[model samples]
Target: MPVIVLEASDFTSPLFLVRTLEILSSCITFSLVASLEDSELNNNPSNLHFDTFRIFCMFTWCFFFTLSLLMHILSVIQFHSLIPISWKNLTMTVAVLGALMCCAASVLFPWLIMDKTVSPRPVVAAVASCLTFLAYASESFVLCTQTHEQRGYMGSMPGLLKMFQMSGGCQMIPLVVEVIRELPSGVYMWQMWVTSVSYSVCVLMSLVTLVVIICDFAGRCLLPFDRFLAGFSLMGVLLYMVATVICFTKILQLRELGQQISHESTGLVIMETVVASITLLAYTVDLAFSIKLLCDRGHA
Candidate 1:
């Protein structure tokens, strides 16, 4: 019998490993900040200063949503040759386009609803935003599930893929919170139901993504191919799930707080801190991953 051992040094690319670890750390930090901030907002709806925060969050959400749509379109156009003309690809293409439209509509609905000055316009925007989030999530899932051979050039850069995922997750937060804020007080039943359903769905999706990533890392049969891209894709899904859960929890808490607490004021401070923390953590992870990639390249 012969003794055998496996070590981190046995890995081909130390740089890649380092980068991956950095990315993982950064993601965890982002989730922590986001979760904490959301919890704070739920606990205290007053004492948060600055009306600008709301506007900033709204603008940021819309900007990312628009950018995501544009990016997806560009990806499709750039990889047009790789796109199969078969029924399945065509169907996916159509679905992707449709999802983009839904996302656009959701992002813009708030503004449009504001102009109506009528019954339930706010609620409408909220519902639209939720739909848009679902569409985005679906689009990502489709992309992740595509066979590696079909992925084409899109599989090249893990960073770019992860960026899109983070962007989607980041955008989801404010829109959801905004909708909840707009709803009337004593609106417990509907909010509770919607929040529970949304959180559960998000959790399930995250778990699926985690499983995919784990399999990829284990070098299991690559169905969708491109492990690098898959890793990033899964990261996005996980991040989105975490953010959604945090947001939903905050909403649930706020609901319980009732009229005694000034939600807007408290929410602003809490959200600002949370968003700021999440943003910083995300950027840090981004930096760490970039460094790791660079190191790998240097070794190569």
Candidate 2:
């Protein structure tokens, strides 16, 4: 009698399959980015689409996919564990770090658009700036304070806030990519307005949250404003959800708008949108976990 042996490198291992799929998806995203860059996008003021949100999305997508790609490569090389719960998986870390880079890029890209002078829309400029500030605040929170799991007084508030902002900021990249790909179609539509308004509110909420965090760090008198952060963040989540639904779906309203645009780039748009939507789930989960931590803290 012979005993059948299983190894991490065996094709039967789930990790091997997942890594293979990830590599395939990464290549797909890379191909889409490459293909779209050379084509005519509605927002390309010339051949320099890099100065717009569309380019930023493609760059961020590439960066994010590359992170996963590298993780898969490392795992493949080592014949790592097949268990899905392997400690090597850093999905949350990658998501947060990617958001950090993207928010930073958003800040710089605006200045390059339109005669290389200043960002044309004040709203975009303000939202991008505010988002950057929020990302920084969240990073500081994560770096300076202990995670809730590690026994911090604030519980997972720091981590939750960081993930929410990161996720929220990231999902916007996909929407922007899609919208820019179909530019001048629904740019001034109500849904876009809703997006702008929600982001503006998010900026205010992030500012308020930052102030609270700042006071806490300074050992100053803490305000009863923690709930305010929770409230605003909750609202942001809802608003973003509604806005995303409007953008991604082929609703009666958006249907007409999309028809006006050439569908030549539809494949690339769908690819980027799918990428964005998948990443948004990470943000949602992190947000939920953070909220749960806060609740646990309160009950304690």
Candidate 3:
């Protein structure tokens, strides 16, 4: 029979505590939302839109909770050593992504269901979701405290900028989704295509690079990593610049032709424009840092 040894440190570490909190809060949030009666929902017919919000919150909480539990079990059993990827990197990636999803869900859920419903389930669920978000954010910060050398590429400033690039891109997604759901198809089709391409490419590239580094494959890359990052960041900058111009122009045109656009669609477009601008700034800085790294490596 195989021995089943437990790693006591897994239970004692601050990360362990954070993960425990994450698991508990996620469960609480999921339960509160799931427990809401159909009668409660029927109280406000307008709350039919809340089905999407409820589903989103439920999925986010369940996904994170399951991951947190699996991570904890793996740690306790010391199975992470057998995993292919860098365990630290995997943990950090989960923490960062979970924090972002939970934050977005927490913000959106309450706004969608709180005032619309008579029951207090959504309000409590929102609080639990916020706590879960905080736990994940704390986990990310804790993981980041390691020395740059120890944490590899993800600990570098440009690497962190890559995270911001991904985050800014992701923030635009909800706005785009809202716009698509609310507005008729083929309306602002060009603007939508351009914006989608810009953020999608940026997010995909950044995510791929992050995954490569996390998998410890950066050193084995065919192209020099620094040069590759420089090129990628430059591409992100150009894409975002074009997106910003097109989106802002559309916004301006809509404002001038005010009656042609609904307030809701206009608000979504404005949010997308702002997020695109911020993401562009992040990409610009990332490009600069990538260039600096390339030059520094060349000199060395």
Candidate 4:
């Protein structure tokens, strides 16, 4: 009897699958951007700022998703060089591509919901959030499967599981905020108040995740810069959350008081304006911090 060994290169390649996923992801990003612009135009005739901001958000999201797609594809290519054409790796590649596509779609929902006739943006946002959740869930599943295969089931660690959950939460909270933002106008004041509360929740989750990552990285002595970046990121999130709550509360109070008294109180109006100003300031700070953190992480 003779013994034989089969190398990874001996297996037939899955070039078509790789190419197909790349094409699909690219097409979805393009479609979502175009649709967002079209939907924005259909919604408002005078609010150019709103339209421009939506376009900007769509572009930013597309850029990130494209980068993520590239990284995933490269990872897959590298993995193929090391291992045979296993179904697990192929499935993981497909899932990553799907997740990227869903994220692209999720980011475009804000513009889609901008159309006044289409009801509040929340309806589209809710669907987008659901899709985003599904994508993260799929990624978590892949990670768990990989862990199980590499180390027997009993070898799984709590920290790894927590990291997965935290990562998923970090990706999910913004989508949740968008969903709340799109809520219908007729909802009770208390229900509308939840929008501000949701912003706080998102900020809290982001901060917690940043802290966990910071602690994890510190324990390994891998990166000190990450801690600095995470700290600033947490500050930005907190400021944004506070500003949102104040601004929304002011706006709601003004609206309710006007409805009940059929008159505008000048002091309340001034306070409302001030809150809006503070909100803008907070947003600027948050944006600056985010850009700095991203640049520091070599992601920008």
Candidate 5:
């Protein structure tokens, strides 16, 4: 959830300056998961695990992005040894957070992708996902309020905007939906309810972040496409929230109707992938903005 938006000058390598590390890592994971789903979903009727496969892909995306991020942060240490202690500490914190998130993705994906009923405590999984999301949301809030002088170029609206977009996968919104989908028969009703609350809270924060961004733009225009993408990403988030909540509500309805699990697939689960793809594009826009900022504003 903690943001680590690297400026063009933040890295010694030209690769990271263009966001090549982030883009390539995300593409590799997305392609891998998509390939597995296409090959294994239909023919193996008894083992249709597309939902978990999607969740795995989402985790993989976050893992790789964070890994690239960590690599970039560490790479800075070798090039800028005389940088301020505060900057050094910031890099260390970012690297540590990245490593922890990667570890979480690695640990959770195996159980989530397992064929059998592996979800014993759905509340725990839901809490973990929501916590990560809230961290991202909180980070967005910080960036929205901070200025360029505070943390260099990353303190601008672009930081908030890009992070809000990235939250599509960063928050594991779809992952929570999938985890609820795969809840074992023995999963407690109260736990499910708790997870539902967590989901709603995250959606609420997403909207709130959008509101904050809009308000900031009303007073001071930051740059091109600043508020545009912020509002755009939130609209997508709102739609995803509505669709996901409806789908989740249907699952609860089926439960009350004496159905253990709903066999019918919700369109929203598929919609999540679309939303994520669009968010990825939003990130590309952010990368472009960062580059222009580096050239125009001059990186600190």
Candidate 6:
């Protein structure tokens, strides 16, 4: 039942062009990495070790490529009107979050996989990823700079905070997962378990909050949305604070325990500790914004 619109303006728009670049760059990155993976398999079948960087890069590219392609398809077919979510909000949210994830992939690919002895293929893929990230960022910048009336709620200040919170929470999920995986089975301390749970809950809440806002459920929800945001932001702050404290305390305890933990495991724990502190800071700032928004709504 969907009809094609095929507007010339749509294809020629800056956003459209940027999206094209995103798709192209993602494909190039994926192809390069795939080729490398193939070469590795053919040349060295014995290397069964996990390559987290390779898988992460491939997943990031594949996800964004598919998402961007879907958006383009929906636009050409004029399917926005039929969707329950705000099309503009959905697109802008994709742009913002895609940019963040792509940037992280770009950084991690080189840091984890590349060195002076490495081949040029991964380097090229990394460059392509960086270009893809820039393309997404360009689209985000254009959408964000548009008039408030033209842009959706996702482009606003509080909305941007939501994006940051969501992205930050997402970034932490991998770190927590890595830490938990690295920790020896049946040896994870209470601190580690509590920290992991807290991180998971915070990330889940952030994702739900973003989804509610982007779907324009803010006004229609049972509880007042601003109050919900304020309350959740406060909860996130507390959760991250506790996670950070426990993470650091565990690191110290590990030092005292000594010789029982692998250096790589300790490093993973330290990385999570640092990231938890940073996420805590982000939540604290978001809490301030949420409080201000709540107060303004109360006055209105």
Backbone clashes in candidate 6 total 0
Which 10-residue span in candidate 1 carries the lowest summed lDDT? 43-52
Clashing pairs in 4: 122-182
Candidate 5 clashes between residue pairs 3 or more apart in a chain or in different chains:
none
* TM-scores, all models, native as reference: 0.34, 0.43, 0.87, 0.39, 0.34, 0.87
TM-score of 1: 0.34
Ranking by lDDT: 3, 6, 2, 5, 4, 1
**Per-candidate local distance difference test:** 0.42, 0.48, 0.79, 0.43, 0.45, 0.79
- Please give, for residues 1-300, the per-residue lDDT of candidate 5 as tens digits: 344455656554433443343434344444444454333323345444445644654654566466446545655445333333334224322323333343344445444444533333332333444344334334334433444554432345464444445345444554555546655554545644544564455456445444444334323444454344444444544544454555456555555755554443333333443544455465556556655655664545
Task: Give the Å error, residue 61, model 3.
Answer: 3.1
Question: Compared with the true structure, what per-residue lDDT tens digits does model 1 show for residues 164-272?
Answer: 3334343344444554554455544464355445434433443444344423332454543343433544444454445446555655676576785565634532553
Badly placed stretches (over 4 Å) of model 2 are 1-48, 53-99, 102-164, 170-182, 185-188, 214-226, 250-259, 263-287, 290-299
The residue pairs found clashing in candidate 1 are 45-266, 46-266, 148-224
Worst 10 residues of 4 by lDDT: 153-162
Colliding residue pairs in candidate 2? none
Model 3 quality (TM-score) = 0.87
Model 2, span 78-156: residue lDDT tens: 4334333322214334434544655544553443343432222433433443343344344334433544434332234
Q: Candidate 4: how large is its RMSD?
A: 13.1
Give the per-residue lDDT digits (tens) of candidate 3, residues 242-293: 9999888878877886776678668767877887898899899988888887
lDDT for 270 in candidate 5 is 38
For model 1, state the Cα shift of residue 181 in Å: 18
